[model samples]
Target: MSQLITEVQPDVEIYIQSIYQTVVQRNPHEVEFHQAVSEFLESMAPVIKKHPEYQKYAILERIVEPERLISFRVPWVDDQGKVQVNRGFRVQFNSTLGPYKGGLRFHKSVNASIIKFLGFEQTFKNALTGQPIGGGKGGSDFDPKGKSDLEIMRFCQSFMTELYKYMGSDVDVPAGDIGVGGREIGFLFGQYKRIRSGNEPGVLTGKGIGYGGSLGRTEATGYGCIYFLQEMLASQGLELAGRQTVVSGSGNVSIFAIQKAQELGAHVVACSDSSGYIFDPNGIQLETVKQIKLVEAGRISDYTLHHPEASYYEGSTNIWNVDCEIALPCATQNELNEVAARQLIDNGVIAIAEGANMPTTLEAVHILLANNILFAPGKAANAGGVAVSALEMAQNSMRLSWSFDEVDGRLKKIMQHIYQDSIEAAEDYGFEGNLVAGSNIAGFKKVAEAMIAQGIV
Candidate 1:
């Protein structure tokens, strides 16, 4: 660690320690939650030093503890007339900048600690986007896999019945994440509208274009990551053209990343899902990948069915060992570890951009920085999704819609601005192109200033 980063703010350190202890006591095995908290504290040390008033606010303590943690019993009837109940949570972490803006995840692992960590990260990430959105995250532990459409609809209605009371277009706007998609958003939004008894189009994003959704929200995160990587590569007189890229996850971000990389003349060799990964040395066929993952909703193992030449691996981590010029982890937190980082470094990978939140572990980040690899953290690189969501809100509020090209052009501009801002902030902080420090400092300053202006609220 750099001496500058090692100099901890005493109050911040104490607060972080308290959070760590409390979380550990509650969920001792949540390694990812602990890792997220540690990274937040490490990045926040400089913020505390620059804004001593943050200590007065005890922002670290307040941030660790959400403003409101809503957990409810979600009971719904299944297609078989069987009753099912699952726990749902919404952690409105902060509201300093504006209304809470974040995604609602629907995975089996959703919990208070996970939601808290995600919500906390969203605060800074949303701030970095220069958007008038605050931070909050909600989700449920109920897995949406294998559920009938009617069953899923029932569950979403049940979930939103409670969520709608606390959310609005100008209050907290939710979007899709992890297991939440167009279908899920449609159900949730329908329920919200029914309960609220009014048509509030801006209450959610990632809706189908027939609704009030923006045109480019689906591709924003992936395309934005490529834009940031392009800027980084350009700084070194390199380009994505002819570069070999590896992307993990077969979800929205990874799929669009593959498409954008191919459009930029890069050969994307690998993409993965929860079941495993598929490697196509001749470059993954984007259409085929889309059909298999998106249309079929099948495991990546089925990818070999379409192209027998492609090989399938049974684990997600193997994507990092495919020897590519660039690596993008679009899966989940800590997908890239020290071993994977070392493999990429040894293979001469030039750059790494996270398409997922905190995909690279702290050790992997340290190794990448030590090796001088161009790396863009998820907060800056993936802000395009949320930025476009904010734009969607604007469009909804104005009862307007933008053309696909227009929305895409705006997304590109926002992404480029975020990259340049991060770089400039890094240079100003004496790090000189270190985007990790740059993003942290850039995002921290905005939220800290907002908190100060809000007068300790």
Candidate 2:
């Protein structure tokens, strides 16, 4: 389990330091956890003074620790008839505002710190959505990249066999993340239904649309990021259409972000995957990208096969060097560091919308803010996925499905609300134009108030 709560402080309060020290006491070596806690806590000094009862009740200490951290082993037989074992985890971080809601990530790099950091950030992220979902995250060290369908199904079944005992429609509900996509979610949901013997579609989200999944769920994060960007720009009397944009990652978020941006008349010039990036000055061809990366599940280098006019680099990092009016980091945590941030500023990048969680390093964010570049933090911008997941849960509960347009409209409004709310929160605490602080302050306050109302747990 992992945390942030807020109000405003002209000074750093001792209570904030004490609570942060409480987190550092046990997670001293978990650097990601440390960073996540520190970022959230650092912005809560004013909040501490305003809500002294939070300090009296030890809300910070309790919020920083997971309500429950479940860990178990998942064993499955590989295609080679070899037994493979991987660690599985579900950190139910909080349920103050609502039941635990988050995504399950599957990758070789999954570990305690990564899960904690994600779960901690998720607390505020979910709060910002103005939804009933609280915060949580789960994943495993099992990499699904080269695994066969049988191996994946076997692993998913095993993972759910141990996990089902803890999950319920009214309890923790997990969707997809990094390695957990529609394929993995289908397998996981099927296994859960088989074990639970119920049609509890709400127990999991990001399911196949035919089976209780919400329309526009897949495209939500990417589209939502752009929607937020549009709102940000509109506030400045600017616009997104007819702009040169660069996006990182060829995954679900980036691909859909590129699509939505194009729909709005933006020319997406570059996009990257693990192998490298494809740059087309004529603007990226969505169909060409989907063919190579989505349908073929091939490397981005193959993009040249269909579009000879485009160029592909050997590594993804260099894609940041290309110039554009806007940048979207949809790749992974801290993908855009200080150097990459400088490159974007040099290219006269006017705005950045994060489509991935914590994509920009702290230093990178500082540079962007200092240069007066409009920035939308991932918690506020990339919230579309979870927002749509919550919509999916609502559909399951009501035994009804929303039309694509209906879902998209709701998502757009939610994104706009998140952006507007962040602005007011920032100004409320003297963090005007600082979306990083604005978002943190806005999301944390809601959860903090909920915790106070619920009393000490």
Candidate 3:
């Protein structure tokens, strides 16, 4: 795909491309990390042109590289007593804003590249949240699916044994992501406490409520996505009420996004899992979905057993084929590509907000922007998860828990401010109405300014 810096001055374009090429050469085979850095550096063209100090101070060079990368072995015994080994990683991308913060995924797809990409994106996402958290990500290539409770517990214990050495309330704070959730968090936190001999709840987020978890952390990312969508629609004198929407993914983020969009009067007709997607023209029954996915822990195809009227398809990404006014890609990175973007556009998609990190490819993003569709990048739209994580850190420090309503209200306000900040930043940099550039610039400027203020580290 062509880079977004093409339209800028030749010198600026050359500078941006040089940085990107350097990133590629230094981090060979890390396609995901390369993609993230390319997208970020492309947005830096206007910034570098307007503020040459960033170049003078070598901010671009420093920001693209992670401060630390920790790789360790995680060996655990399965239920059958056979030993297994999985590689784990923690990419501390940046700490200029504050301590490193991000989630720990436990999917088989996880590797150094995936962790670095997530950490790089988390840095900007945390910055946009107006929180003190820095950017980091960690996970293992350990597939949590089909693992028994004891097996998972053993794995968590083994993983945290190595990871706990680097974690602290004032240092790195890891949360749940992908295959990691409340149950996994409980096991990991238990292991951390056992090893460290301290009750530092702030060391992690997404804990069970009876423990030290925040009330609305589970719904923050999904609900925050809709809140951002609400603000984006309102900018054009539009309302979410009565809009037809399709949200991909059936995980925590997707489920809550569907719930909030429905609450606001939008008809969310479709959601998906890795196996396939389910479309309910009568509007998805959130309770049934929760029961099947969360309680029963079954496949999304089973959603049709409860509601025969709905149709289930075998392809997950094909969910975009369903016609809708709004599209929320809440699934993993690059779930929606150029074809999906064009499909949504052909079907009259007026707006899109990413609920997952870089869910849409750069090509898809360009296609959406060229068509004048309202696009909210994941960094700005899905910052809610990390934002609430920051809040949970505060709550843990104060030894107080906020009510669900209180946390939700705060999440809404933070999302609003992020949207507004993106708008103002975009306009200030002569990229008015282009939220992709706006969000990148807004987030980049915040971290870059901090990096400059603190001097070379």
Candidate 4:
């Protein structure tokens, strides 16, 4: 709540006040969620200044409060014949453009606040893709890690039992995020099919390819991020060739970002997991990292077993201190802070693209913007995964399968268009070349216009 932000968005001030009240009442302890919302709202200052009409719909208030919130109790039997109960939630945040679409995360940290924030971000991310999909996210706090296959299946079935009632092919379609992968999707889809007694293949995305998943859905996010960076650099007459890049997170997005970076002639020097980061000055071999992460499903420390040149750091925040031209944070929210931002700036890092949701803090984003670093927010840059997921839904409905090249071509075009829109938005706001401002303004305008036309629904 700075004077500058208020001055830029006087009308949005009411919406921000509403968000604060809602956060205080419902989720006082959700500091991270508040941080994400505050940061996003602050970034929308330029949009509010340019389009005062957006304030009529109270976009921030609607953005904070989901259109629909569904919570259900899931009862399932464990392996030891003990009954276990978990809560499942699906926040159908918005559907202004089309059907509700997003991922269903099954992690220990899944909560109403987390899902709400994710869903809010997904709404704009979906709109930025220029696709006919809205925003919704569902998940449970049921941790699937180390659970027996039967146990996981039981949990998914019970969760889907309630979820199936609210989902359909042309309604809310969920995909995989942190923990809800192929196995979880398979279980959820099976239960949905059984419960509904119909063969609605488009009810969910990220299904097994054998069922209805797209060919490049798995690698779309990471590859899409790199593709965005590629376009950003190409606009400046540069490329990834021979540049050093540091990527945080060894998950699906980061792993493929590393691979695609290598494919584009960039040398990936660092990667990390939740435990810590592994730094290899000699450049991390994609095959080695893939075998250690994908095949073995091991931690980043296991990477040193094959590549003795790499070193592991157990706890550190300044991953950008390693020095590189490109920094892609494929990790969780606010992983990159002002300290990391300053380090990146000092280390001569030229560009940053978030592969995770709101990976950079507000201060970090401002620092990057002040330094003129080419930065792309997660909502715009990482919309590829969900975009392809939507494509998967389209293919499923058509009973058609596209080749790898065809799907990949569409993904690349979508990402490029997003980048172009972001650039145009920045220029329109008089912050030309600032992708941070560009992305926020571009996405906010789309959602705001839809909300206004729909008359506060």
**Per-model C-alpha lDDT, please?**
0.86, 0.88, 0.93, 0.85
Off by over 4 Å in 4: 1-27, 316-318
Q: Can you write out model 1's per-residue Cα lDDT over 188-270, one digit (the tens) per residue?
A: 99999898888999999999899898999999989988988888899889999998899999999999988898899998999
Better of 1 and 3 by TM-score: 3
Q: Arrange candidates by TM-score, highest first: which order?
A: 3, 2, 1, 4
Judge candidate 2 at residue 50 and give its lDDT.
64
Could you tell me every candidate's TM-score relative to the true structure? 0.95, 0.96, 0.99, 0.94
- Ten residues in a row with the worst lDDT in model 2? 1-10
Give the number of the best model, judged by TM-score: 3
- Top lDDT hit: 3
* lDDT by residue (tens digit), candidate 4, 1-457: 3422534445556655566678667767876667656756665766766676766557766766678999989899999999998889999989888899999988888888888888888988998898899999989999887798899999998998889888988889999998887888999999999998878989999889998889999999999999999999999999998999999988889989888889999989999887888899999877887887777778888889888988998864556679899999997878899999999999999999999988898788888887889898898889999999989988997899999899999999999999999999878766689776677777777877888888867
- In terms of lDDT, model 3 sits at 0.93
lDDT winner between candidates 1 and 2 = 2
Model 3 is weakest, by summed lDDT over 10 consecutive residues, at 1-10
- C-alpha lDDT of candidate 1 relative to the true structure: 0.86
lDDT for each residue of candidate 3 in 395-415, tens digit (9 for 90 to 100): 999999999999999999999
TM-score of 4: 0.94
Off by over 4 Å in 1: 1-30
Error of 2 at 215 (Å): 0.9
